[model samples]
Target: MTQRLRFRTSIVLSCFVATNALAHEGHDHPHEAASAPQQMVATAAGPEANSFVADGVTYQWKHRPDLGLQPEAMVAAAKPGLHNNADEDPETGEVVTVVANYGLVKLDQQMKSWSLVDDQDPHFAGGMNSHGMDCFTIDGEVYYASASTNTQEVVVSKRGKVIARLESPKGTEFDNPGVNAYYKSGGRFVPCDVVWVPTAKRLLVVTGYSNGDFAISARRVDGAWKWDGVAFGGRIQQGGPFLTGHGIELKITEDGIETVQIASRGHGRLYGFTPNGAMINLNATEGQYYAQLHNAARPCNLDFQGDLTFVPLLDSLPSTNGVAPVMVLKNFESTGSLIPAEFDDLQFMRHMHGLKTVRRDRKLFAITLSWRNGGENGQGKLNDGQIAIFEAVATQ
Candidate 1:
């Protein structure tokens, strides 16, 4: 049976425009403008046939075709997982890369290709639409969050097996009041990503919409999983303006302060909050920082290291010839700066999504995905998806 699922991107963008308009009321700044154009410098290409060196970083390219992925299928959000191979290199151990498309797939080191891990898991209850996922290793078991379907619930899995399903703490029924109000459309939680916060001992689930629209909910999972509370636009208190809770990261400062950073897609702003849900005042320079980088039209995932963070800007509305770039920022404290970076001019890198860092042999690497529309029949030549791997080196 050929069942057509409503294009989620269109629905999500529509919600973003409506919610963003409401959130901007009474705010003084002009929300739609970038402070300055991004600055980029070209670098020499790499020596390897499939490699490129830019800004002192060396990257090796791989594609979905290399792994025998169907042209109609798509996958986004590449994250490092435990080495699933026993014959992996002893010195340079292989790291399995997990991607969520129709289901979870892991990079097979031996085959140098991608393989499905949990597409037919019974816990999916017959419907499996895996979106953003994050992993945590506790007690030797790797726990991951797979945003399944439009129910806005996260299926917690360990070792390719479903452990539990988390949804509204209020209950599964839609139309309930309060935080439950947002789930009324039969789309309770449009969760993008989920991360385990060791500092607070809770799981922070990033939802594209919540009660009153978008929000990030904290859930406790000591013996049983339950909602600790929810935060809309960095506030525990509800009834504020709506914001797109797309991507989230839990960061601990040098001085040991725990903070949660979120990519607000609706308003085009990156926000930092304490574990208790108080916004951390960034005090960024006018016309710089979030003011310039926040673009609702091109919001993507965020990855952090120390005080530095990387955010990939995927497809922009109206489209820019299908080019996406990554932004790197430093400090992230009261005072920090954003550095401009460039994306390789790869023909397959259209519509980028998901960003994460990986380490191998003491070298830093980045893995990202790109999606192209496959047309009405879902078989367009350009409608496929690809995965790219890059080795990052700090440039002086």
Candidate 2:
């Protein structure tokens, strides 16, 4: 007689007990929900071939648990760094869609959910080559965010080509020749400096450099790849209306776009700008505290919504006196700073190289992950790494 394969058919739920009546037995494990899953992969077991960059440093990342390196080559080659990996819909708990490298040759992610992801993913096509730059997806299309603050480019995988170029006002054909109007890198620095603007349908890059003395400038986002608006080397910084490259952090929303800054010097400030270009103070800045930079820099970012802004204050006080970490203003409510010393990956037990938050939002957050453990050709400390999710809450 042949035996039939049997799997559990019923889902165990809670028992119902009537008051003073026959008690109904309730099971603890409920049916798995329909949406995404809430999971956190440890540093080592995560995707291989991952990169997280912070303040000019980069780190390698993998799943917290290496699913058992079958072929050692596959183990070393697999690296999926962090890039807005997690999401928490006020409706959903905590879920993350990780970016990873399947093999040493390409990039993708395994969306960890209720069930183990097999060979398929919701956003999986094939693989996009990242050319050593950070890889991420804007809307299921692969895009790479370079480590550069003033110049970068984004290539849409589906488009099968480099559709956009992100650059500061240095080499572009713009009318500017003074210190105040110089390119951002030529003067200051910015944290998530350049990115693709899907709304305006063009590449958007922000600047705040010190080639001059720390200033802000954005690419001429002309709505269609040609309609450049107010091209100002003059980006606004934290605290007051200073034209610099740092505009806290840039974010897109329903109302408009928002840029923020966090400060260790005086009062913090955030700037609210329209997608088309206009400013209005939203009274979201002003979180004065005493802190110092220890080893590395702190990361600052902002999330803008209509008139509401959520400015982040980060990279507390540094301990060294080398290249003094700076925090600049983006508006009346936003500020920018390198990820401070405490959060520096160099301080981690399994310290990879660079792991800094490049950008963030209520639902998604980005980190530039790298693996140059040491100075150049793989000489640093990290043998393995996983994404470290921090606890945070945003009020805008």
Q: Which candidate is the best by TM-score?
A: 1
- What would the per-residue lDDT of candidate 2 be over residues 1-396, giving only the tens digit for each residue? 111111111111111111121111100012111122122111111111123222233433322222111234333332332222122111122221223343112211221222212443322222322221333345455543332331222222222233444333343343233422343234332323333445644333343222221222333244223314333223223122322222233354334433222221111223334333334333322321112212122223333322322222222232222221223222221123322222444232122222222223333232222221222115543323333323122322
TM-score of each: 0.63, 0.39
List CA RMSD, all candidates. Answer: 11.1, 21.6
Model 2: residues >4 Å from true position, as ranges? 1-160, 164-192, 196-201, 212-227, 233-269, 284-314, 318-396
User: CA shift at 92, candidate 1, in angstroms?
Assistant: 12
Candidate 2 CA-lDDT value: 0.28
Task: Give the per-residue lDDT digits (tens) of candidate 1, residues 1-396.
Answer: 111111111111112212332222111123433333252111111133333343345444333233323223423322221101011112223333333323456554333555555454655433344445666655555666665434446777765577778765553322223444444334345566666777666677666543234444555456566665544342112333234466676666555666666765554456556665555544334322232343333445677644446665544332233344455554322111111122333454544556655555666555555444444114543423455556554433
Worst 10 residues of 2 by lDDT: 20-29
lDDT of each: 0.45, 0.28
